[model samples]
Target chain A: MTGNIFYFLTFLTLIAAVGVVVSKNPVYSVLFMILTFFALTGHYILLNAQFVAAVNFIVYMGAIMVLFLFVIMFLNMREDTEQHKPMLSKIAAAIAGGMLFVIIIAALKDVDTNVYHPAVFDSQIGLVENLGIVLFRDYLLPFELASILLLAAMAGAVMLGKREPGERNRF
Target chain B: MELSVLLIKALIIVAVFGVTLLIATYSTYAERKVAAFIQDRVGPNRAGPMGLLQPLADAVKLFFKEEFVPANANKFLFIAGPSLAMLTACMSSAVIPFGNTLYINGEYIPVQAIEVNIGILYIFGVVALGVYGIMIGGWASNNKFSLLGAIRAASQNISYELAMGMSIIALLVLSGSLSLRVMAEQQGQDLFGISGMNWNIFYQPLGFLIFLVCAFAETNRVPFDLPECETELVGGYHTEYSSMGMGLYLFAEYVNIFVASAVMATLYFGGYNFPFMYDLGLPHNVVTILGTVVLFVKILLFIFFFMWVRWTLPRFRYDQLMNLGWKILIPLSILNVVLTAGAILLKDEFFK
Candidate 1:
């Protein structure tokens, strides 16, 4: 049953992700992307990563997507008058994406799948307690470093958005 | 049969999501009424008794309202924007532990919809992605005001999320666990037989404060509501959205507020735990029910507090918001982590 659910969710996610890439309208693309996230959340739940699934919905779907929608709405973008991408660029993007996907699949193929030991999936491991232990005890420094990266992103955003003195009509 | 177990789980998940949706809906009504009350006026009493059915009325009105698609707007994205908002807003409650486990016929049923290691990180990761919804919506609207609002919202969320994550780090260090259930269990037990001092909030008050402030900003509540300061941006990112699209954005904000409150209650306020809760010695089912009720009550109080603050404080200026988040909160959070570490080391060396 779990396997079936996982397969279904994966199918939904991949299809919507493709839709996001292929859709002509940016708004439709964003919506499809959100759908993709929803499907991904389902997948996470199937994997027993309930916290990740919930956060995926909250952070990505709730916070990030809201920002995206807001930006798309605010920009009031007109239909693209620009011509479609050159054949070379399109082919290049496709090739790169295909190569990356192939590489990922190839990398996974070598892993020993038959060694799976199905323990009574302890709910405690996935609870906030275990996550806290791992984060603080093992990944504390890297976690702090992520904060630094966030700080830098904030600085960059402010610098980009700020109106410098005597820079009128800058758009 | 396994099928029966799966069905039960699915039903529970759907029920939780449904209840959250209902709460989100009513929150909108409550917000307006509270806003009116704070401003000293009769709130929406016409929809039903005390305007209890105002949300339903509003939903109907929104449905019947004429939908306007801007001439230059990206129609697909414009429509997708609000749907994304509503969908994502409802997604975060899956991992929350609503109550303790209930034993039925030798089977133990966990209160949470799903349990996962790295639950807190998952919350952070998903929340990080929420900016895209606004960015896409705002940009698709093809309106300058909307674009500006979207950008503002994105920047605001990204900024505060850092401090928020930092605040969580301090708690993580002290709790020595990441799973909400484990954390709650730890908090439930008194430290070294000291009564009423087991909660993380007592040990890490500064971290709790920082997290609370960041939570406020994360939810885009006032005074951090720079993205939708009506006087300037003219409804901000949703300027071009009408009817349900607009409603979705507004409703999502309340839901996000609800999620944040739930997280706060779980992390710092001893989720579902009350003073001397064990003393009651209630039946297992009753205890679990009481725990769930306690959690909801805490969440409601937090929601009320959110409304109260919105009425009490003025919105922060854009630059000021940035300064507070980056210069003030970030540094303070860092210092808090250092202090927590020192305290931990001292305890290990001297007390141990």
Candidate 2:
């Protein structure tokens, strides 16, 4: 039953992801992408990574998707004026996507699945207690560094996105 | 062999999710009433006793309302925008531990939908992606105001997320766990036998303060609600949205607020824990039920507090919001982490 659920979720995710790339409408593409994220969250739940799945919902579905929707609504691009790109560009894009997919599949095929068994750890290890202990004691430095990276990103976003007082007059 | 257990877990999850959705629906009514009262007017008292049935009425009204597609709007994206907002908002509650485990028929069943080890990080990661929904919706609307609103929303979320992550790191340093249950367990134990001193808020007061502020900004509540600031961005991102589309965007915001409040209570307020919980040593069923109730009450109180602040404070300017997030909160949170580490190290060596 679990395997069936996992396979179903994986299939749904791939389908939606492909829809995202192929859809004519940009908004449809984004909506499909959001569906793709939701399906991926289901996969995480199957792996027993409940926290990661919830976060997947929270971060991707909550913050990022909201932003995407907001942008799509704001632009209000009329379909009548939206001309399809040349066939050459479309073919090039399709070929590139196909090549990437093939490369990934080929790489996965070489893996020796028979030689591998899932590593055994205490079931409690995935509980808040064990993860906390590992995060604080062993991975403390990296944990702290992640916050710093976020800070840097915030700074970059502000500097790049915000309009300067002098520059506003030109508009 | 264990199909029953899984079934029970699924049932509980559905129940909690259903209840939360109901609460979110009413929260909109409550917000309108509260906003009215704050502005010195009678709130919705017409729809059922004192507006008790207002939410249901509103839902019906929205359902029957004519769906308007702008003449120039991208039809496909226009439809997708609000749906994404609603979907992402409701998804974050899945991993939260609502209560303790109840032992039934020789088996221990946890009350949470699921217990994932990296719960905190997972929440942060998912919330980061939520910005995309607004961005896509606004950009798709083909309205400049919507675009501006979307940009503001994106900028605000990205800015505040940094400080929020930092504040959480400080808490992680002190608590030494990412799992909500373990964090709750730690809070239940008294350090040095101090009565009623079991919460993380007492130990990491500064971290809690920063986190609370960041939560407000993250949810796009008032004071930090620049994304939807009416005077400037002309209804922000959802200006062109009508009928159920607009309803979805509005509903999603409240749901996000609910999720944020729940996370705050879980992280710093001992989740479902209460003082002298060990003294009762109650039956497993009672314990689980009581924990669930306590968690709900705490979340409600946080929601009330959110509304209270909305009426009390004026919205922050865009630049002011960014400066406060980056300049003040981020630095202070970093200082908190360093200080907490030193304090913990000292306590281990000298106090022992």
- Which candidate wins on TM-score? 2
**Model 2 Cα lDDT, one tens digit per residue, A81-110:** 788899999899999989999999999998
| Candidate 2 lDDT tens digits, B1-352 | 3889888988988987997798798888888888888899889999999998999998899889999988877687678778877887887787788887788879988788877667777677657766766776787687888888888888888878888888888788887777877787677776566522489888889999999999998788998999899999989999988889999988988988889988988888988777766667678689678877988999989988899899989998888988999899999999998998999999999998
Off by over 4 Å in 1: A1-171, B1-11, B191-197
Real A-B contacts recovered, model 2: 0.62
DockQ of 2: 0.38
Q: B161-238, model 1: which lDDT tens digit per residue?
A: 889989898998888766888787677776666532377788888888888899888788899988888999998889
The TM-scores, chain A only, for the candidates as listed are 0.83, 0.82
Error of 2 at B25 (Å): 2.4
RMSD of 1: 5.3
RMSD of each: 5.3, 4.8
